[model samples]
Target: MSATTAPASEIQPLPPAENARATRETASSAAPAAIRHYLSLPFAAVLAGIARYDSVSFWPVAILVVQILLAFLCDRHIRAHERMEPKRWAIRYALLSAAAGASWGAVVVLWFVAAPPANEALFVLACIGVSAMEFIARCRFPYGYAAHAALSLGPLVVLLLLQAAPSSFALAAVCICVSGSLILFGDTIANLIAESDKLRHDNIQLIAKLSNETREALQARDAAEASARAKSTFIANISHEIRTPLNAMLGMSQLLDRADLEKPNRDYVKVMLEAGRGLRTLLDDVITLARDDTMTDNHNDSDPALAARAVAQLLQPHAWEKQLRLSVNAPSTLPRVAADPRRVRQVLLKLTENALKFTDHGGVEITVGVDEPDDDIPAVHFSVSDTGLGIPPDAAETLFEPFMPGDASYARRHQGAGLGLAVAKRVVESLGGNIGFKSEPGEGSTFWFTLPVANASLSGATDDSDADAEVTPPSDLTLLIHTGKLRVDLALSRILESFGNRVIFAESRADAAARAARETFDVIIAGTSDAEMLAATPGMRAPLLAVLFPNDRSPASGEQILHWPAPPRTVYAAIRDAAIRKEPAAAQTRDSQEVAPIDASAFAALEKSLGLSTLLEILQSYIKTAENLCENLAEASAAGEWDEAGRVAQDIAGAASGLGLAALTATARGFAQNVRNHEVEDAHTLRNQAQLIVGEHARTRLALASLYPDLAA
Candidate 1:
């Protein structure tokens, strides 16, 4: 007889208890459909037995009716108690199936023994059909199918053999063969079903495991982002807190330098100033590290040669202090590169600073050139080579990691937090560039990086030979600057005095007007608040260069204006331009209909100076201020209060300029100009007034959402 169970190797075996439960469940669920086939068979057999009443007696009919009742009862029991006490339930199911087979076997035997030789073949055929039905119904359970086949065919084969006739013996032989074949086929079917179920279980487990892993990965990513945000916030707040006192110290040091003190005391103050500046530089490096990757994409076309020259100029004093020759070798006509000028300057500054710090005797050289073409994208290459102590072999791998200096010994001569190279690497990579170095121990190190050219065609279009040329204010020019802020006064006095110009401070608009009337000054510098009043003063002939603050108004006339906190060189250039221009340039007009919502260059400048968190705070403040000013402007305009409207418009313009909202700034400036000139009654000026109010709200919202998405949310 075929084995009652599948081979163990053919399918992974479940635990004994689970195997039993699975078998019972599969059998129970299959029982309803399996029993349906037998249900009709028992009723049909009873009808056949009645038609052959002479040969098959009432006993056969009674047996068929009993089989029908047993089928219903077994189905009901299987359905009601599926998977309950699986081991006992499976045994009971097999026994019931076997009993049903035996009942059919008894019917077949009784009919065959009573019938004549001619009808004996009919009974044998009936026995074979019932045995086939048994195989079909119970094949999924090998033990059940085997028991059913053995009991149903066993009695028929024996009775035929006992007849002692040729036809009866042949019939017995056929019954034995059919029983063996059914048992073999049923075993194969059972093995296949078992394999299918095992595969299903494995797949379910695999899917569950994968789902859990994916969920964990997402959680880890979110956690990492949150931690990064928190770190950035902490660094920005601390940097801002430190800068306030640091600035005061540096400013005091500058004040001390101007005081009449002993030589030793002067040297002491100088050292204090240098130390303070160094600390401030380290704080800036930390802030740079805290800035997010989004800064990389906020760049405009920049001149590498110009940036290189600028870095050299800024570091010239340090190089002089160290007695090292600092030089820049860059072509004046190099193509503009796709990088932020300030960030480019920062990377160069870090690299050059490191080179200067390490090298004591020899000089540092900066070289800029076009790198070899890479995939048809031209790139500008910049390198800072120094004759410093080259990197040790052991430190090469971690040289660019933060705080990992080339020489980490406590007694190492170099002094730094070792964050310069790390900051430089980050800035370069963020701009989609590669930075690396070549060093030889005890010889020198050459650090290099590449930035993509913004436009290949503009390679030879720019000439920057004069970029580093000093702008000398006309010799011994008398300049009058009107300002109340000490910081501004000190800064301007230093720059103007450095160029050998006489600077006169004005306490108020009236004082500035009186100074201009009496002094015959070459250039008059005053805040925008006093620009208009001073210009209207009788006998005032000096060109008025209006110094604009964030909350200051642009003069209605074609007066020169300079943004506050400008580079000293920029201030010099502006002064030179103002002195030479024979006439006030017609007020430069912009397309009133078109302007960018945010000036990317200006926004980047703000972010670099203020840090992201502080910049966002300023933006939030500006949004609130702009909204209120817009409301005030509308009210004043409706009341036909031109002076009040003009003041509000100027406030709006200043606030817009501070946040780099170009569209809002232009609209508000035009409205302010219109109000100042008493043109508010005209359609054009009224339209500009409406635009200023509407554009302020729209532009500020856009700036808030784009620059600081977290706060916008």
Candidate 2:
């Protein structure tokens, strides 16, 4: 057993005989029994020193010593020989205790068989000590230790009681019960702690992984936004650069004379110039849309009329070129709304341009009306309706999306990238408004939108420029003093002069106030910006009319402040209303009450003929009819009911067509034509679309009430 040689029991061996020989040879110096009996050293030594006791004590102690020794040796043997399963790693240490516990069971049986208990008290005491250790082990390895404890203690307690050792029996039973309870309690606590540890470890790992993933996602988002911004900047810069040179080239070309050149040469130059113009126009539209997308925080509650008039004036040529009648109607005292004038003008121009482009026979009309104040904030609604090639029923809502052409074939017929509506929609939404359309395939479409208006009374300025200067000069109308820009003053003056009215001019607020103090004037027509200063003068009872510009950043003081976006028309209307009024106009007047009602007879008759008297009826009928039409169309396409489906569509079309419901008629006709031509490909989709077209007619009729007012209840 030298340290250099190592113990013989620790050596590896092949056979069972070899293993036993090695174990014995190592223990020779100590005692050959020492290697063979590892755990029994204490028990064996104790027994050998003690005097012989009663058979009860002797047998139980001897058996217990033998099993403990055997258990220790066997545990060493198993560990050396066997490998553990990775999957069972959780109970690796516990498994060793479980194997040791098996030897306890063998000892219990041997003790009972060797000698029946004479003094059962001694047997019970030995049993109690052994079982307690077994129970502790059972808490580590539930099944193995449980078996050992039960066998070691169960029979000993029973034998003690049978021998009239009731106290010993009761004590043994109590010890067993406590041991068992401890084993169960320890096991539960161990398992709960293990589970908690496992969950905490997993949560820490998950949090680390999530943090890494979030960092990656944020980085990607930043890169994407940066790339988008760069691209937009590049487009805007390049477009502007290209347009600057392109504008010069086109202007020079236009200056070249056709009279000095051959007809064909002139035509080639003209074509090239026209192509450049078109490209420039496309570039301008792209830049505008891009600018609007990026621009922020430029809101002003100013004069809206100026912006509206500018857009109308810009688009007038386009409308006139197409022989389409265009008119603008803005009220005299429209509440100033917070908006970007350039963007607003751009939106209006785009809509009007689209209307004129598509319309061949009918007209485009632009109307700006101030809706009654809601929530102390009035809204100004701008409507652009046109008689043109109306939108397809299926394409109306999609019209505002980028690059979505209604008819691909008609794309060449119209020279546009279909970005007009897209740009307009974006601009309107950026200004806190919405853009929507109502159109039929043939009759035309009306696009309407609303924007917030600044309530007049909330504003600080008041128009009291001319209160004192008065001569009850004539029964006929006469303008004592007029103040406006050149174009506005001249236009208003010419209009009044045509009606045999006298006119005076004041270019600025100072001049207008001076005229008010010195001379007599029947009425004062001044730009809205100067109206507040003029109205503050004494005895200025003559009605004050304001001429507002598109970009004039003045707040509306009250309804008395006329925000005539179209200065000419609003000025004329105001002058007429003021002159015809029985009492002198108040300092603040409410919004005009001269709203025209929309005609409902046509709508009502159409509804009645369609068997829909109310909106509910209309909606229900639409749903039912849509469902039935779709089903019939689908079935017909499958069963070759082409002629019947075509006839049904034609009938529907005829009814809609006669009533000027162009959108409905167009959809019905498109379906009917498809059916007649045996082109009922995807009939289900067409049927659903037909239902929507019919439904839109009902919606449009209802929407007209708000627009036309007469159809309201």
Candidate 3:
């Protein structure tokens, strides 16, 4: 079992510390098996000596037996204490190996000297076989193997050389070569064992480290998910709370504007309303940022031109206040775009407002038109160019990061939360569009974005009533409307009257039926409940327009339905279509008077300027004020104090507008109007007002409290 040395290149050397540890482990592991081999080999030697007993003495046999007994003792000790340190065990095994080798050498020397010259070759062969067996057994421990090989063969070699014969010298030289070869082979085998052991140790350590890192990574992921959930809950709750009072304030202010006040007071109310709306806009931006996922839905066909025009109108008041001209320049024929009209309006509002806020001298111009096709999708381009202080080069990199304004100085003239561009960028990107800007400091800036055009088929299907196309109401038509709620009735009446239409109101289905029997109207508009009944009424000759609320079921096929809370233009378009039984011709001009639910920009500014603590206090104060006003309103209404109720509604509108709660403000404003018109005498009318105000307040409070749990607590 002699070992052949492998090529040095095939064996990788281990570091000194690792090599030492490897060697100790290898030796300890091989000890038990090597001990068993030692015992067997010595037994074989003893049996051979007995076979040659006629020619040799019993001394050699006795020596072999002694070596076997020693091997047995070492094996027993190793098995009994398996937990013994490798290095200490290896040393003890080496000593046992030395003793075994010396005993074998003595037996060989005795036989060689006693045997005849005829048996000299047999003894030499026997010595070589024993040396080979020793090498195989102890090779894993090179030092121990080397000692055994040399000791076992040394006496035989010396005896042969001292004979002074050529054959004897040749035999001695062969023994020397065998000894050297076995020692070298043992060393090579030892290195291979060391490298193997070191590799295993390294692998174990690497696996442990990987497991630990994986555990930490999982923990981090869990923590992140928890934090995300908490953040989402907070945003939803805070948004509701903040919006409640804001709506109340804005609604009250709108109602106040309608009161017979002096010009100065009217002007102040207008300013307050505008400021409140602005604040609501800012709050919306913050909410949008926190709820980024919401922006991904509702991509519908929209007119880029109309959206641009609406933005121009919405900000025109601000422009007028700043004494700057604001105009929208859109192509007469622009393609309908694939986008969310609300989001588009939001983006435009942000850009234009930023432009208006920054510009000190020149006007802001909004341009909308078609751009070169991209990926075979036609796109509509919208740009807001303002003669304001252009963005600085240094601020360009972080300009689109939320709360990072172009002018970040604490004393900067224009105050903002710096979320306009950030929000615009996010919205455009989420809508599958690109947004960027070109600016020269102290000169002006142009911010632009592009939305893909709507599919040709969709655009063509509704081509007659193009979203950008205006539809003029038939001023000479006599319209009869079935009234339900006071607010809806008043709003619809005012809208229809402004267009020069002679409108008659029906209080119930019976009244509508009666009115239909008497009047020959061009168009009959009724709430969803009375639409069918009025249409079946005797002597009814006019086309029916059903006003559907949000929760209303879908109208029957071929039925003309108008969604409530629609823009005035939409109402006119519906009426014109119902009256003529065809799409109305596009008018030259149109105006949008719709108000947004919240103003994101103003809210952001308030949040940034007031710090979290101060803002929290403000929110707390607003909640308290709103609660008091709600109680005051209920008391005033119960006492039939119409004037006091109107005053209370005005106060709520002021508070809501200041906080940018547009929806609540609008509701409160309508409630106040109903009071002023003495329309709250009816139980239904009074109940409706109370429900609207209370519902809005509850929503606002819940939203705010959710956002700031501390406030709720």
Best by TM-score: 1
Candidate 2 lDDT by residue in tens digits, 1-713: 22224443343322323322322222122232324444543464234223123422544455456565655553554344343332242244345444444445455445545554454445445545545544432332344345545554555555545656667567667756765775555444333333444466679899999999999999999998888788777875676557545755654454342224665776677677667767776776677676624556366554444455445545543444444565555533456666755566667777887788778886777777776655775678888888888878887667777778666667557776877788788777877776787877888889887788754432112222201111111224667545455754665555455334788887567877888777766677776667777778775666666655444656363314445333233445456555544264452332212211122444453343222334333333333443455555456545655555554454444333323344554566566656544455775765664555455445545555454453454
Taking the tens digit of each residue's C-alpha lDDT, what string does model 1 give over 595-638? 56765554554454334676666566556656777887777777
Q: How close to the true structure is residue 236 of candidate 3, measured as C-alpha lDDT?
A: 68
lDDT of each: 0.70, 0.54, 0.69
Alpha-carbon runs more than 4 Å astray in model 3:
1-88, 95-140, 147-200, 295-342, 359-362, 369-381, 389-398, 407-415, 431-433, 450-713
Better of 1 and 2 by lDDT: 1
Please give the lDDT score for candidate 1.
Answer: 0.70
lDDT digits (tens) for residues 1-713 of candidate 3:
21225575466444434434455555556667766776677556754554444344556667778767877775665665455665676677678778878877887777777766765766677778778877776666666666677678888888988898998888888888887876755555667656565576779899999999999999999998888878877886677667655755665665565555776887788788768877876787888888736577564777665576556645543564455766666643576788877778878888898888888787899988788885887788899999877888999998899988988762145558787788899888888899999999888999999987777432213232223222333465788887476666766777666445788888778978988888788888887778877767778777889988655776563458987655555677788678765224333111111444444444444454334576676677667767988998788777766666665675565556556576676677667656645656785667557666767777777767766677887
Task: List candidate 1 segments past 4 Å from native.
Answer: 1-22, 25-87, 99-141, 150-196, 333-336, 373-378, 408-414, 453-455, 462-713
Candidate 1 deviates by what RMSD? 19.2
Indicate whether candidate 2 or candidate 3 has the larger lDDT: 3
Winner on lDDT (1 vs 3): 1
TM-score result, candidate 2: 0.44
What order do you get sorting by TM-score, best first? 1, 3, 2
RMSD values, in order shown: 19.2, 22.2, 19.6
Q: For residue 215, give model 1's deviation from the true position in Å.
A: 1.0
